[model samples]
Target: MNLNQYIDHTKLGPTVSLAQIDQLIAEAIKYQFKSVCVSPVWVKYAKEKLASTNVLVCTVVGFPHGTSTTKVKIYETKEAVKDGADEIDMVVHVADVKAQNKKAISKEIKGIVKAAAGRTVKVIIETAYLEKKEITSVSKLAIKAGAHFVKTSTGYAPSGANVTDVKLMKKVVGDAGEIKASGGIRSMEDAKAMIEAGATRLGTSSGVSLMEGEKINGNTTY
Candidate 1:
C-alpha cells in the first residue's frame, strides 16, 4: 500500500505556530499526504496553503476531551467546514457512553454530521477511556448516526492507538465505516500494524520521519 496516502499528516499542539504549519504543509505537499490535520484555528490557513494541492484540510472539534456539549460541537463542525476543512474529526462524549446514554451519544454525532454538511466526519471514540464493549457500542452508534469514519484516539489520552483496539474497532465498524488509527503510531512497524489490522487512515505528526523511514521515540504528535 501507499503509506503516504493513508497518512493524515497532523499537528494539533496547543501552541502550533504558522511557521510549523508552513513546514507541515510543505512536507505534506512534498510527500503527497492524504491530508493535513490541524486545529480549527489553522484550518483556513492550511486550506489556502494547499489550495492548489490534492491534500485535504482536516481539523478537530472538541479535541482531546469529548466533554463538549452537542450544540457546541455542531457549531464547531459548521465553522470548521466553513473554514474550508474537508474533514472534521470530532471527539464523542465518553461520559454518555459511561452513563449508557446511547441516545445522547447518537444525537451528538448526528448533530455534528448534519453540521458538517457534505464534508466527511470522523468520530473519535477515545478508546482509552472506554471499556472494550463500550468501544464496540460507540463504534456502532457512530456509524448509525452517520459518521463516515471511526477513529481510535486523540493522542492526548493516557494511551493511544493499539493494534488490538484497532482490530476490535474494525470488527465493530466492519463495512459500515472506515477506521482511522491515531494516537501512538510512531514507527513504520506501528503504521503497518494498524493498516494490517484494517485501518484505512492514520493520524500522526511524524509523517516526515515515517516517510524517511526513521524510528521516533515518542508518539507525541497528534
Candidate 2:
C-alpha cells in the first residue's frame, strides 16, 4: 500500500506555528501525501505553498467540538473554501446525534456541504462520545446529507479511531461515501488496519513518522 496517498498530513493543534505549517507543506510535497489538513487560519498559506504540488488543502470547521450553530459552521465552510481550502472537515453536533434529532443533524451537515460548494466535505462524527448505534445513525445521516466522507474522531476526545468503529462506519456508508480514520493512529499497523476495514483517507499528525516506518509509543492528538 502506498501510505502517502492515504494520508491527510495534519497539524491542527491550537498552537501550531507558521514554521510548522511550512514544515508540514514541505513534508507533504516531499512525500507526496494526499493533502495537508490545517486550521482555517492557515488554509490560504498551505494552499499557496502547495499550489504547484498535487497535495490538496484541507481545513476544519467546528473543530474539536461540534456545538457551533449551523449558520456558523456554514460560514466557516464558505470562508475556508474562499481561502483556497480544497476540502472541509467539519465536526457533527454530537448532541443532535445523541438526541436522535436527525433533522438537525442532517440540516447542519447539508448546510456545510452547500457552503463548501463543490469541494469535498468530510463529516467528523467524533466516535469516542457515541454509542455504536449512534455512530451508525450519524454515518447514515452524513451520507444522506451529502458528505463526501465520514471521519472517526477529532483527536480531542477520550479515544480515536478503532478498527471496529471503522468497520461499522464502512458498513453504514458502503458505496455511498468514503471513510477517514483519524486520531491516535501512530503506527503502520494501525494505518493498515483502518484501510483494511475500509478507510480511504487518514488524518494524523504522525504521517512523516509513519512514512519513516517508526511506530510511536504514546497517544497522539491528531
* Backbone clashes under 3 angstroms, per model: 0, 0
The pairs that clash in candidate 2 are: none
lDDT string, candidate 1, 23-58, tens digits: 999999999999999999999999999999999999
Score residue 215 of candidate 2 by CA lDDT.
88
Question: After aligning candidate 2 to the native by TM-score, how far in Å is the CA of 104 from where it should be?
Answer: 0.5
TM-score of each: 0.98, 0.98
**TM accuracy, model 2:** 0.98
Q: What overall lDDT goes with each candidate model?
A: 0.91, 0.94
Which one is best on lDDT?
A: 2
Any idea what lDDT model 2 has? 0.94
lDDT of 2 by residue, 117-219 (tens): 9999999999999999999999999999999999999999999999999999999999999999998899988999999999999999889999998888787
